[model samples]
Target: MKTLLLTKEEVDGLICMHEVIGAVEEAYKAFNSDQVVQPDYMGIHLPSPRGEVDFKLGYNKANEVISMKASSGGFIDNPTAHGVPNGMGTILLFDARSCALTCVMDGSLITGLRTGAAGAVSVKALARKNARTVSSMGTGNQARMQIRAINEIMTIEEVRAWDSHPDTLARYKTDIESEFGIPVVTANSKREAVEQADILVTTTRGKGSLVEADWVKAGTHIVAIGTDQQGKQELDPEIFRNAKVVVDSMAQCAEKGETWHPLNKKIIAKDDIHGEIGEILVGKKPGRENDHEVTIFDSTGMAIQDNVAASRIYQNAIDKGVGTFFEFFRS
Candidate 1:
């Protein structure tokens, strides 16, 4: 048997935002139609401070592919101590019928792109048609990808951003302006950013809520992407009280994502959730019933995202003859 091995650079070259959005959107539709099987994300936290590893696995029956990704994060000392990134991951792809290993590839870049694409999908389904002003919290790599993905679907006349690090915020402003030819405004506070946004994206890794419910406007569509862990939170619990809450995965979000906080506190019940993004994609449920409605898309990264994304990248690599192929097993 031969297996394909792809590096981060190879994967990045093979995948683009346009294809990623389409692939992720299809994965969501498949999930909504009961054509995918995904297990709950599993995590193991180290006793040492601020370190953990998690894995997500799923099978896309429609595509006849199975994927598993194991990733690690919150190792803050890695950069200073080891001169390496704080987060890293590996993705494995297998044939559904024979369960044979088909490909092994870098998953870190895939994770960021798929996650950004998920936010873009929500923006397409929930945001108002005329949304042009975007507010982004956190000027990190994820924030950059989020904005790029949004620009793929919306006009994005202006961007307002806030970050605790002034240097990072400044760089974000310069980079975005130079790349997109749009004005990037550095906000003094999170509220300022939220108030100026037609579409708001929160990608921070804060431990507590950085946004207030009162600051959010009625017609705003917010994509809360930072709070994927138990203690992480980016939006106030009150935001979910009256907002049309759409989660990536109800079962996973109820346990660890942004929905967990509100659900655990009884701020909102299971019935309060509008529906999964997949349901919205398949037209099983409505999205953005009115412009005056406040909508929130709580994203807990899903395994199907990795499955579809990896599958697409794998095929793209094969078609383009990008990645190296090696014979691993002898008959």
Candidate 2:
């Protein structure tokens, strides 16, 4: 049998943020309903370049496909040193019945889109219904993707962004304002950005906490990204003491995500976790009970997200005849 192969650009052309968001939402439903098999993700840290490679593998019974995504990022010098983007990855999709490799495609773009979609999913379910302002930390690739995805789910009246690099923040403001036709401004400080947001997104890679607990205001929904690995702290654990914390996967997040720090430090216990995002989506639990309470969605990323996304990409490629096909297993 032949396998389909697609490059990053081809994959990007095949799927968009809106489709991926809907797919991600469906994936979470299957995940909690026991229609998907996903193991906790694994991460390997590199000392030299200060990077991380993460492997997410899963099987979707509904789609009858298995997939694994290998993604790497955080190499600050990659643009100059490797002549490549900082984040890159590939996805291997297989047929469940035959256990044969059916598709090989670029995963980096999917990774960014799925992640951005995940944040939007959380906002749709957990954030305030009237949220019109979004504040974010770290204006990079994922930041752009998140803003694009969130705009699809809600009407963002304005966007405030903060980055340690003034030039980066300025560039992000310009690019966002130009592309989305929205008011984009640079925040003078992290507190100024976050406190003003009905939804606060953190996408930094700093080893220490970036957003203080007190900086967060009531009714604000925080999406904690960039904490998929151990020791990556973006929000103060004290926030957990007051905010209703929901995670993509409790088993994964307790050890490797934003929830890990608070659990280890005794700031909050496992039982304090409100529920999985899937549970909220499937109506097993409630979302944002009151407008006055704060909420936190700790997104460590999910294998189910990768599985559903890859499956959709493969099907779309086949339908559109968009990629190269080769019989790599031919005798």
1-331 in candidate 2: lDDT tens per residue?
Answer: 9999999889988988999999999999999899999987788889967688899999999989999999988787899987987878999998999889999999998889999999999999999889999998999888998999999999999999999999999899999999999898788998899889899999988689899999999999999988888878898889999889999999989998999999999999999999999999999999999998899999999888988988888889899989999998875
Model 1: residues >4 Å from true position, as ranges? none
TM-score of each: 0.97, 0.97
Global lDDT for candidate 1? Answer: 0.92
- TM-score, cand. 1: 0.97
Model 2 per-residue lDDT at 39: 81
Number of backbone collisions per candidate? 0, 0
Candidate 2 local accuracy as lDDT? 0.91
lDDT of each: 0.92, 0.91
